[model samples]
Target: MTNAIEFIHVKKEYQEQDVIEDLNLSIRKGELFVLVGESGSGKTTTLKMINRLEKLTDGEIFVNGKDSQAVSDRKLRKDIGYVLQQIALFPTMTVAQNISVIPEMKKMPKSEIKKLTYELLSKVGLKPEDYWKRMPNELSGGEQQRIGILRAVIAQPSIILMDEPFSALDPLSRKQLQDLVLNIHEKFDTTIVFVTHDMNEALKLGDRIAIMSKGKVLQVATPEQIAQNPANDFVRDFFKASLVKNIYDVYIGRVGMVQGYITEKPNQKSMLVDSQETMRAVFKILSKYEYVAVQEGKEILGYLSRQQVISYLSEHEKD
Candidate 1:
């Protein structure tokens, strides 16, 4: 239950303009927390402050319960792993060399470093024999990213900072890397702070997501809560932008409010449908169940009774 990172009254100014103002947030240890927003929203800036990539003009940031300012950047970064969208591997280094950078820097025994490097490469589905000596350009985009992630995690840092790490890859590669990240978190129980502009990506990967705009956080909640009960108009529209454009032009999330569906605490036995599912899909589940739970990813948003769906359909049919 301890916080891995905390921002207190944080502020960052650039050219006399407030890039981040009065920010306060905390990320729990071993949790996969996400920061989501569009460009210039300060989500990226907020992430950088944790590792001191962007220095805060005012206030404090605590990493692992200690004042971040108290630690030298070199030492702090050594304990924290970082992954980036650009996959900034050393073009001159081999894959094994890149993955073993941290351990080597720490003066770990050469044999130990090689053992760990090969073990991690295999963990990510790369063959040690084939990839050990490959240069950055020898790998494909996705392969390069896999190596980038390996480099970050090779040292087994408890906290990892990911800045749009998968954003530059193709859709298939992105999904694969996302799954890899989820698997890594489960396997290591590491505290991860992931930043991305894609809402769908956030919902799929975040245990809790914080939405930001104009250097301010708009809402912070589970993906399900944000989907069903957005904190404001901006939040609502942000969630909406990720939904499928329904043929009826009625947003599924809006149907519960416009019609009548009992919002209840998530029940373990309820039939489930994603909030992004089409109306036809909801009807199929409703045909067999009295009520179906609406969810986004693994989080339950609310419930929609069969009656609620029928009533809305009949009303639309009449029109």
Candidate 2:
């Protein structure tokens, strides 16, 4: 399948310093591609380039096989949705009005826009009746964040760009929004390019990750591949820190932790857990059951015992 977004030898320089250098990437249709890096790594700049919010200094970017530069800026932007770190809601506008901004700008029918606004609110886990008339100040930080997402998705854009959209929320709210985004992605099948400095968040949400540093992509691979086989010393140290913290984010809820234990019986005694849940949560579950089920969303991926959980934790501690 052709990529929904592609960057070829893309470079961005300002005053003789390259913010992004000779970058190449391809994000497949309907896949979540995450970019992770330290501060000043240019992840945000690269994302801006995709939506033409930032002009590329050199090379090319393509969206759905069409040259991005060839498209009219307004039309191109209208085809891509963007959610930024700041929840840029219009304070004077109600939730429904804020969400309808894009569609209204597109000259959509009033009735159609109203219907779509309600649908988008529901999609972002908000009830229309409760949230529609509320202003930004009346909503919680998390609720505002959801409104930001709803505004972006209201247009049914083919691709979405998220720049640390959950970074400003509390941990509990962040987790809720993360799961909400994943659920929406699955239902809508929209290609997403998400940017974060949080390694755990990147691993949990990304289908593939691109690790960047000093304006260059250091590694691009599945979370498992990056964890098990780091491409370089920096990558190795990255996982090392995660391991020391007992946050094996990449492999937290993946299959094959306990071999030959997955069963197919419906209503089987099992524990339900989020893929992004901590290993400590797994241990707590194991404390109660001989074999506790592991899960990624609603799908079961076999079971592990108390002994296995303890043993795995011990071994990782040694590392």
Clashes of each: 0, 0
RMSD of 1: 8.8
| TM-scores, one per candidate | 0.77, 0.79
Candidates' C-alpha lDDT: 0.86, 0.83
Off by over 4 Å in 2: 243-319
- With candidate 2 superimposed using the best TM-score fit, by how many Å does residue 223's alpha carbon deviate from the native? 1.6
lDDT of 1 by residue, 225-295 (tens): 99889999988887766443222434355576677557675443568766655577677777778887777
Q: Model 2's lDDT to the true fold?
A: 0.83
Cα deviation of 34 in candidate 1 (Å)? Answer: 0.3
Q: State the weakest 10-residue window (summed lDDT) of model 1.
A: 242-251
